[model samples]
Target chain A: MESIRKLSFQTSQFLSFVSKNQILLMSLLFVSMIFFSLLAITFGSYGLSIVDFLLGKTSDIQNTVLTEIRLPRVILSGLAGASLGISGAALQGLFRNPLADPGLIGVSAGAALGATLMIVLGGDIFSQYSLGVFFIPLAAIAGSSLVILMLYFMTKGFGYEGVTYMLLVGIAINAIAGVGIGILTYISSDSELRSLTFWTMGSFGGVTWPLLIPVILIIALAIIIMIPYSRQLDLLQLGEPEAFRLGVDVQKLKYTIILTCAASVGASVALSGMIGFVGLIVPHLTRLLGGVNHNYVLPGSALMGAALMIIADLIARIIIQPAELPIGLITSAIGSPFFLWLIFKIKKL
Target chain B: MTISAKSISLELGGKKILDNISMDVRPGEILSIIGPNGAGKTSLLNVLSGNIKSHNGNVSYNNTPLESISIQERAYIRSVMSQFQSIAFDYSVEDILQMGWLDHSHKDIKEDLSAFQNRVIKECDMENLIHQKFNTLSGGEQRRVHFARTLLQLWQPANTKDQNYLLLDEPFSNLDLVHKVKMMESIKAKASSGTGILMILHDLNLAYSFSNKILLLKNGRVIEQGETKKMLSARLLARAYETFISIDENPINIRYY
Candidate 1:
């Protein structure tokens, strides 16, 4: 009887603590993300286990596979997912719309168009300049920045009324970028076409530690810069005018959010082709489980995004064994249905 | 100290929204701006609050140009409660009220305001809805919540001598009789504590009862302005609104058919 009472008391205490402290909940989420990353790193075609590697029982081939190939893939997936998730949360809060995502404003489409152009055109013209590996990511960043600039200029006149126009413009821009990609696809060589197709579909197969490090740094810096704006973002949820009246420099906040989201999403897209749904769904999930305060939502989204991507990548790897499926396919398959459910739940509310 | 707007005119899309409007609000006084629909009362309020830039005029606060004061500094001196209160996210009522404390210095004012916030919450009758989502509240409840938030923004400790102002646009809209009286009492208390209030109220009776001064606006111009008892005559109100109005002298109220 005494043991049972003590156990119930501990259970109630744990529940109360979670209810009281959001940072504690975020830490728990981070631990789960670490667990998912470990689990993801353990699986692959080679049947490598983290336990064996830690115990010093793995062979040289296993070490190479774990350290060089699988580890980078896992880390890249986590980083890309985190960037998308945090960017989504930031954009949603900036726009004061729950449905706002990075893709909603054409950042991902712009990056994809840039990568497609590089894959189709850069190899011939830029190869002589020896811009081999650095060319594509640079082009991707340039393209995303151009879109962000266009969005800024297009929405400049409308004040708070510009949010709806911004979304409409985003759709138009996405269509134009899609047509551009189609033209590039039609003009490309066979190998270039194959790579472009894979790029649009999204994958982590080509990630290497050397290529991943700089992109990781860029995304990490953007997210770190975003952390201090949580209170400002919360104020913005009251609407633009209200936020301004509360002493928030709404214009400065807007520019900062746009630039940071562009950098993070642009870098993630360059690193891993076009991972979809993570940006759209991870933020919603975070807000659903937690509250809408960006203070918790931003960090919660980062951890949740990392976990979801790690799990999705693991499924993509193991579902077909030696032949891998695209991570985007797995994410959309999981995310779209969940998104519908969320819509229905919100309607009921 | 006073906030004075001189010859303020605003044109939007070639239509004059506010034309050469001038007004002054002093500390510890309640000034009510009243007019019919599209009379530019809200536009005038916006211009006075520095939310809108007038095409031709100057607004000064305490003998200094209003535009020269930084937005963060202005936020401490004045708080505005707009007619439209939109909260996109599902923040609780308490969370919404806490946003008003954003500009408070982390000194004695903030430390003492924990109790002040509670008092405003109770005064606004939002004790039951403290934890409720802001979006889920009824329209009247939402208005009270915003009123509480504005009160918190203008809240100062008992010993502080710095003056502040409240600019409310249609604050009593959608409120029932009881809440309207409660909100008026709260505003009176704030004014008595030396916070100037400039509000655009549609209810002429409430304005007559509560306000010290009145400004009647029509067609983007002020029709009459003076002490409430002197300026709120039936002839001035009927001429401004272009309708017949009967005055009840003993109780001091106007009736519009």
Candidate 2:
């Protein structure tokens, strides 16, 4: 009798939670994201504080570590997480498939192949140029654009049959990229091999001020493009022709989704290599927490993703003192198990 | 003015789906396209709805070419319900239903979707489905919910020159008898409120009962068209369906046995 009463109370609480306005729910997520970001900045080997930075209490080296390393990594991780999360939400709605992730479009793998080729082949040659930091990212962008171009041609500007063709072409591209990466790995030197391994495992250690700017611009552009189309994405869940009848320019929507997703996912992979499961897990969490309306899901997923990625990065930093674990490892390790739990919970529902 | 199609022809996968079809649906009239299987009734409906753009002839909406109108503008003017609308993820029934309000900018509808909620839910028997996840609903329940959503898309203003249209394909397929009657009544009420209705129906009895106008199609061609009472002639329906159809008088019944 007590247990039933407790269950009923919890049910009422959940009902109240879901009934809250969507904007209020999203504001909660936004506040949480800010809270996590501020908290993450205070962590790491060289301890820093917002209070200390504000009061000018930190020494020069400490300030340098805070400014040059900690700040960039946290912001970049947040940006990359937001990009992946929103892109994942948009792609899932566009594909009308729950399993569609940022990587499903072949951008990340294509970006990986590009970065790997640049690292393996353009060693000291790019060091002579002033844009040494920009070379690998540039190559990654080029590679992703190549895949995007191919997809555009194959689908004929993303017409009615475009979604299916995109998935199939994405598979082929992933396979080809895997082979290319494998071949590059075999040819790489010991130091190159180590860097390649760490990069693929994923980290925010290499994040810097210069590299942050383009990523910021690109991801911001992607988010701006995605949010307004949230309703169109929701309509797409009704099916293509229904969306068309409802006045969504289906072809234009398809185009916007693929391109924005590619730009942001490509930039994220270029900034931080192969962060798995954040894309898949973040949007699913937002949909589960808030309702599945893309209006809430898109922005909520973005905020939740940024918050989770920062918290995960903090855990990765302090899990083993001095030696940090890969952010990708932490995300997948926690994410996959949580995903299973969600699936079981869904089954129960 | 009418939503007119002029000599529209569509060929898909080397098979003729609709051949030189011409028809129109006007505001406040329910036009039912009825035929046997493989009669291209759905094909004709698709062409008229502006979904099949590669068709041979022209489609005009209220005297303007359908292609000239932007999709966003057209969405405000018409609502379509296809044969199937399978959602990919778990959305509450409220979420899916609220999607119909995407293009609703009517000044009279001062509030959000709640204004029509009571009527829509009651008519479609969706009171229990309010907070439920859409994917978990039974097939018939899902159909009812979709019907509710389709009804919510078009509103009944007192008197408006600019009319909205409701296009459906086999909307009654998964509905039970009582629910079908209720849904048809809701559709008729929408029509009475000056909304045009164009639908493809497999059930001749329902078509004959509900529609003001009817088109009988056979093998990508119209076998007969015009007033529902006259166009549903037993001999004409027999030729269209290629079956032994009989109509008994006194109570007006049509049977193809």
Candidate 3:
């Protein structure tokens, strides 16, 4: 009787835990993301107040900082971080392996190759045109899509027997794309090379309103497309045969999810070139806090990703003072060690 | 409802694993497939559950081609539990059960799974093992928990018209005598409660004692299949397993090890 009573109490506690945690944690993180975003907008060359922003009493200094400089940077960083995190979670779940990430699987490299090639080749064609930046994002998306399509067809034809081979092939593809990027670097002019190098290192240096729209739209659309897939993602962790037995169309689901991850990562990488470890770290942290269920993992990762990137950017701006450090350097400096620790821990287990 | 397969065959890695095997399972009855190691028993279960496509012939559920049915509909009809589960994670038993409730509604899942889990734990004498991590459980304990997971998959809304079926591959292999008997009794109870059960067993005596029917497979072909009592004679058992046994039939049923 005592045991029965204790079991019942524990069950009630678990149900309550899931309920309270979902509502409480989600709102807490969402609000923190907004707060940090606003904080990020407020701290650049000039400080602005919430009253001044709301009342539209904008001075030249405040307007320039808020509109031209910090606002777009914060918004773009938020979108890029969210996309990377959610896409990472999706790819990891789809592969049923925790180490799988969109950037690691050559999606970022493929997009980088496409963008570099476009800048090199399309520079000549669009020399007279003002909208030269347009073709780079477009080519990046197309190139990443092409690589995803190639990988998908290769796996389909290989008959799903070799999963480890897929990972190895992804690394090989990234290495080949790296060679392509090197060749593009050799022929480019010094000014263009400097811009490419900064972009490759990843920065929120240039933020215009027009660039922000597509970034926000694509990331928002990706998140929306991903929400309904959480339940299927949960079913997939049981492995492919078991997932198939449980009524998931395993091949079709894999293709759809990989394509989605590829597209989202491609778009984000095009906007903010190769921001590392937001995807890897955010999803794992969400799992630790929210449990393994993707319903919570997806949204939680997005919020945490945005907040982490915003905070990282804040530190990057303040640490150097007047001249900003590359945000990627900060993320990698923090993320790489933690990621290595995770790999070791998993291996030990 | 009934499931019937005719002349099913499988060739893997340029080897014939199963060839031209035939079997049937009736609704609300326990069918046991008894065979030795390397006899393709698990592979046969995989074929029945549609994990692998057959090189020849077809399987049907109530005369409908099993392959023609949607995966969701097929899942609603059957659940399978293999002998080995290698998830290798630190998860609570309740978390594992929640995963089993994937095809179930949130409203009824908690109530139904907890109730079923309670009944299974009581029946398997596994009440103490409930809160333990799955990787921490003993082999026998893990088997019972996996059985609970499979049972959860078998659960459905009361009004659904589909016939529920279970395919188990050597569920009693690692269990002690008491737990083994209890599991057999639970399977028997499921049959009585209107679920079809097909299990592969290595022990012919257990098959004869618990099941309504016995299927003796040798080299991917059925040597004999009929009502358990009439089909499990010493001659047939000896031929199926290639082992001599002294039959000492007494008031209490017994078979010498």
Candidate 4:
């Protein structure tokens, strides 16, 4: 019993030690993610041997499933989650609103509308070409870019009023995108409606290596772009006028935030459809776990977001075996209640 | 050296908010801008701090055009504490204070960061509240935290070098008497240590007591500007404020009814 108590004390001590150093904490998260992902791959419907897979002795079918299907799906979900998480954190800091998220700002909705329109109208034209995978994602990016550009032009003032305009314009654009998506949904064919439903209720089942690479690159690029602005975002939390006075080029920072967040969020929506709540909840969770300093919060949110997405995807895939639930359904089921709990917890604090 | 503005005019929606207004603040001195409601005190601050880009005039900081300096470079020259700040997220007071630290807020780039952080916390009298959540703090405590953070930008471990500045807008609004006095003493200390100070003050008594130079403004135009003792009078204040006022020469006090 004494030994067990000492062991437990040591574990807690180690945990505290790791938590204090954010770089160490994030590195641990990253390593655990890799380990957990490899472990997760051994699960699922197909009978696969972890030992054989590790030893490179797995069968052809196992290799195909692991490399082409499972790996891409896992990676895509993780990337999407990271994108949403960092974008949420950046937007919240940029707009100086705790509730700011990619979904709220119309990036996802606009991406959905653009893809849905492309699917309903140009579905036959793109699918015939080998480069068809690029079309929908490109269209989605275009739609989100339009929204961000509109926001940029509309919020052409300095200080708090500019931030307020960004949020208001985001809401207006979100509503318009919603209407457009509704109209397109009304007009789509049976097959198109199937894809539309897939978009509405997000899934990670069908993604392949070809489709996943561009998205991973885009999200990786966007996150890299966001890293440099972490300090500026911290200053922005004080409000724009003060931020500018303290030597932040508010206009340039705003432009960078809008572009990078919109681009990453658009790419994620293009691939994963609509995975809500990760972006909104991840940053808040990161802040609660550590502190509100963006240097740590940005990477911490990304790592935690990827971990959460991996787990959510694992549950979504394994719970029903061969037949699967939409990733969005599971996330919403989990996220909404957790968010409500978080709200109450924060209110009490 | 001085932060000087020359014939600055600001117009918004075809209305002249500031009509050819000019003022100067020298290092190691406190310049108080006193006026009533809607008198363009905050607008002038906005212009001076480079927070407003549309103003038509020249603002030079330490002999360089304010517009020519990069935003980040400007923090090395001045710190501004504007009124009515509402933070969006909950962060520790320590984190909020850290926001004031620029690329190099310290004199020596290699100086230990936490040393200055500790000094500013103690200076602002926020030692007890430094670890608490900023949003959870009371209005006055939050004000102290912001003042501490604002001071952190121009944070000098001992004395400020020549040419840096502190611009405050109603910094004492929410503080109790104790904190007000504490903050007042610190601001006074900062001014004495070679930091030029420009502040918009509501408390005429406090302004009259500490201000070395006074600018009396009425409806965006300068009514009077000179040494505080000459520029500040019951008659000038009464005319500028459009109200009756009284002053006592003993120990420097002003009373408004």
Top TM-score prediction, candidate number:
1
Each model's lDDT: 0.79, 0.77, 0.74, 0.78
Task: Provide per-model DockQ scores.
Answer: 0.25, 0.39, 0.32, 0.33
After the best TM-score superposition of candidate 4, give how far the Cα of residue A8 lies from its true spot, in angstroms.
43
Docking class of 3: acceptable
Better of 1 and 4 by TM-score: 1
**In terms of DockQ, which candidate is strongest?**
2
Model 1 chain B scores worst on lDDT over the 10 consecutive residues at B102-111
lDDT string for model 3 (A31-111, tens) is: 999999988877765567756977989877777777777888888788778888888888777766677666666777888
lDDT of 4: 0.78
User: What's the true lDDT of residue B77 in model 1?
Assistant: 74
Report the lDDT tens digits of candidate 1 across residue range A70-178: 9999998898889899999998888776666777678888987887777777666544564355666677777887887787788773256667787798788778877
The model with the greater TM-score, 1 or 3, is 1
Better of 1 and 4 by lDDT: 1
lDDT of model 4, residue A54: 86
Better of 1 and 3 by lDDT: 1
The ten-residue window of minimal lDDT in model 2 chain A covers A1-10
Task: Kindly report which residue stretches of model 1 are placed more than 4 angstroms away from their true locations once superposed.
Answer: A1-19, A49-58, A124-135, A148-171, A190-194, A341-349, B103-111, B157-160, B250-257
